[model samples]
Target: MSIKRILPLLVVVLAGLGALSSGPLTAQERPGPLRIVIDEGVIEPLPFAVPDFIAENGAAREYAARITRIVAADLQGTGLFREIPKEAFISSVTSFDAPVQFGDWKAINAQALITGAVSVSGRRLTVKFRLYDVFSGAPLGKGLQFAGTTASWRRMGHKVADAVYSRITGEGPYFDSRVAFIAESGPKNARVKRLAIMDYDGANVQYLTDGRALVLAPRFSPAGDRLLYTSYESGFPRVYLLDLGSLRRRALDEQPGTMSFAPRFSPDGRTVLLSLSVGGNTDIYSLDLATGKRRRLTSAPSIEIAPSFSPDGRQIVFTSDRSGSSQLYIMPAGGGEPRRISRGKGRYNTPVWSPRGDLIAFTKQNKGRFHIGVMQIDGTEERLLTSSFLDEGPTWAPNGRVIMFTRETAGAGGTSALYTVDTSGRNLRRVPMQGAASDPAWSPLLK
Candidate 1:
């Protein structure tokens, strides 16, 4: 079937599945066949099972197994679903169309079941899957099929996993996204930093710049086709925009005696917000990409940096030391009187507005400890998600349910690495990287 036909079919199937519950529910009061309640307290991950996808032909056998494993890994990585080992299965899923042995799955306490099939024709690949509510002995949603090139098998797996995750949790999909970061090498004093991009799970690492120059704070454009970062190639910190397709870059706001850094793209991707330092003063300015015009957003003597636009482009959240200590503040998008949003004791920096627009994630340093935290847009209900020797530069996932940040160890030999945690502060784990990495910025879900 053509992709045009496949998408509409998938949408119709998903719609027919019915609306999902949005609030937390007790096990006894859970309204759906399967649900994951994200609460303040500890949560027991729902048990799930995904047998190897049935290969429709001999050529598809290997692809089927790989895709199945990827799907399971994606679900388990969320800390919301625990996969039941294949060895524990009482009955095997031998066919894609076979009715699931609900009693067999329930016996193992598998709350959710996933069945799939894979087929290959030359360079074309197709994946089909069904999610079941084991206890209810019914399909949670109609079966869905995805078609793509064989080289994109990994994405096919991610799409299936995204569908399963969203259906069970009532959250958006995030599995099929990319992350831009500063890949590091050499010793701490003279470390080499290069621009790099990778899959959300740190797969397919591709270096975008040579390590000859220092790079920091890679921010993805709204369309995910370009990046805004700071580079020291010209012997001074300056903002540079890099195009991913052409691998070309150009410095922005290149004034005679001014240095610019800490750049971020506005939600619409037409304007760039950056901190430009002239003489002894630093302020925030918005640069129009098309006309190369600069508009100052803050005219304060106190330093203001790390500005991020709200999803709707109506407001901006940034860090300023105007309160004597670094704290987060919000101002109108077009520059106006600022409102202090962070009332916490510690210093706050690198405030990133969540894509959902309900929360802002930031790095906080207090006493001798550093932390990554999130709070309501108004800065209420501040909750720290992580604390370490040096944790800074938080970036939100596309769905805003997770935050990825740079965490450095201590001492001279301390190395930086990337870590992710849910907004609830659960499932803290390091992303797999060959060497030290930091300053991660997640891209939006890929089209």
Candidate 2:
């Protein structure tokens, strides 16, 4: 189905199955009591408890425990919620329908409490959960239930965490999303690279391409069913579109004398913006997926690449060296005069527009050090969030509250790893991975 038709259906399904808020809070609304407000700067993580879910039958005993652990891990990883250890619990929940003893939870200093039940019938698994305000002695929100195959129990856990996070923070959930990146192995001088996709928390990793071809910048389509990447499989840098389910790929808008790379999809997924290099001069071009027609969006002598569309699809943000240093520029979606957006004293590249449309994340280099930073659309209020030997390729979470990027340490044996940071420039954590990884692109939350 076309993206125009599928987008609304996915939103409806996520609202019904995941039980997320149909209408989010407006900017004028004050945050709830359980909200983790960052408006005043850094704050301590909120403490919460998730007791082991009640196992409805023998078949669900193992799943019940595993899902509860996964749910706790998801919330704790955000650095916004702290999980109280099970050993410190003073109360035991034996029945899903039992009334909660809010006093028992409050004694342990847990501001939030989570209880759930798990059931398994053949290959199908079911989980239902509720969140409570321990001190208020009331349920924070309505109970939610999710069902899927036993193999997908982890996903159901993420859905529950997403719902809880949205209700408490007044922001969209990102736990149910995926990240596509380039996995690296071997020596730094001769690294082997392949395209890989995984859960948002760096679990369930699956490689999409072999190491025979060098690939860079694997970007997901708006629907998360396809990928756009630059590959050297054809002896020259070229753009290729790959189907995630079929494992099939084909060249994209190839031209005989020009090299194409750094491709990204429009918000509607019906068009693509790419960098086309001819005779060493590079510019940005947009291609219509339906008609195979191409239009040039940039016509400067300097190089321009890494084009990303605004959330509303009305404008484009890209990296350009027109100002004698790599910097960010914004232009109308249909092609027009560009305006510089990076005014700070540093070189910037890989400018990615956040899903929230409030900020643009980019990589900055100054004084021989690399950093990840974000700025408003007009390039004001710029803030650098991270600094390291090498930090680049900033991609936004589904909620736009956090960013994931590539960080490389110094030295010959030092390797690259994926890291996440909050937009406020706090809570930097390394993503758990077995090998070097880079060029992360986050997917929209799963339906």
Candidate 3:
């Protein structure tokens, strides 16, 4: 099932919460309540307070404080929430079941309040939290608990934040997802690119490649167990499928005279769509994983690359230079004539279908400036989210509410870094990293 269908079920079953309403309330109907409406303009962040989680025992004290800070940081980073300073609070939550002082929070104009507790027993850790609408003087949702290994405390914190964010914003949760990207090092002339994965917040980075060969565009499988990326280890760009569990990788397409790159998985994870070049002519093709069967999908004279499947796997969106310049085109997944979708005044490339199946994100180049932008599937209502000397390779979050891409500075000493922007074109911020990075692809939310 899609994340949209599974999210409500997760809340009811895993979190042991009551059934959620059939749908989210509109902003006009829920005015003065604890909610956020993501619109097309500047949004006043909703103020919230996350006090230090209560430590049930001595062993849980440090974890409690650290998890509390991470939860608050996750919400604050979204630009939809503002964390009230702890020093400004008049009341403290000393116990997990203590009554909330709604009047104190209201005095500080806090629209939402979060309270949590942590306990550590041997190697296992448990966390529980509750969200409150201060204006209503009542709990927004029933309390939820999560138990896991002590080493996974960070994920536990993210789970709490995801619950809180979903409850307030009425949007799907993205905090628990992961991102795969190319980590860069060394000088601009001899840069070393390695495959790496990390939490959506840029934490818990784990390198998958040794930086010996250049890797690009690491796309995660629907199940998040494998990745498809382009590697230049064999003197030509080729697609490689890597088993994330075993850290083993092999070339997916090794035709003697053909080069294959820019691979993405079908929604079912049984087929792969990639750009294949033969005798200087590039087109899109599909490869079956169970059998080494290859079928060409595009037969144009011009280059057709960067193909992506729609959410239902029935259609595809790709970039082609057949229009005299790079542009976006959509066609049936089984191969047919494509219809152009982009009619803007720029060259569009790297179009990715949003998981929600509503918008397509791409990189645009116009008048010597690069930008990250999105548009409807029909190519209407085009909106550019970011502009820089170099910004490309747009990747959608699991929830389809945010986009992450690479941005490179100008000049010899310039460096590439990862940044994220919400669909509203607000909350554009740099993702914290130790070195240069690019080609980011977000994974589906963990099961």
List, residue by residue over 1-447, the lDDT tens digit for candidate 1.
222221111111222212322233333354665987566377788899999999999889879999998899899999999999999999899988776799999999999999999998887788888888899887776677888777677878888999898878878899988899999999999999999988888877888889888888899999888899999888888999988766778999788788999998988899999999988789999999999999999998999988999999989899899989999999999999999999979899999999999999999999999999999998899999999999999999888899999999999999999999999999998998799999999999877
Residue 246 C-alpha lDDT in model 3: 64
Top lDDT hit: 3
Tell me the TM-score of each prediction against the true structure.
0.92, 0.93, 0.94
Model 2: lDDT equals: 0.87
Query: Candidate 1, clashing residue pairs?
Result: none
| lDDT per residue (tens digit) for residues 1-447 in model 2 | 233221212111232223432233332263446777655577789999999999999999989999998889889988889999989999999998788899999999998899988998998888888888788777776677887777777888888888778777778889988899999999989999999988888887888788999999999899888899999988899999987766678889668888999999999999999999989999999998778899999989999999999999999999999889999999999989899999999899999999999999999999999999999999999999999889999999989999999999999997889999999988899998788999999998877
lDDT of each: 0.87, 0.87, 0.88
Count of backbone clashes, every candidate in sequence:
0, 0, 0
- Superposed on all Cα atoms, the candidates' RMSDs to the truth, in angstroms, are 4.8, 3.9, 4.3
Candidate 3 lDDT over 207-302, as tens digits, reads: 888888888889999988789999988988899998776666789999888899989999999999999999999999999998979999999889
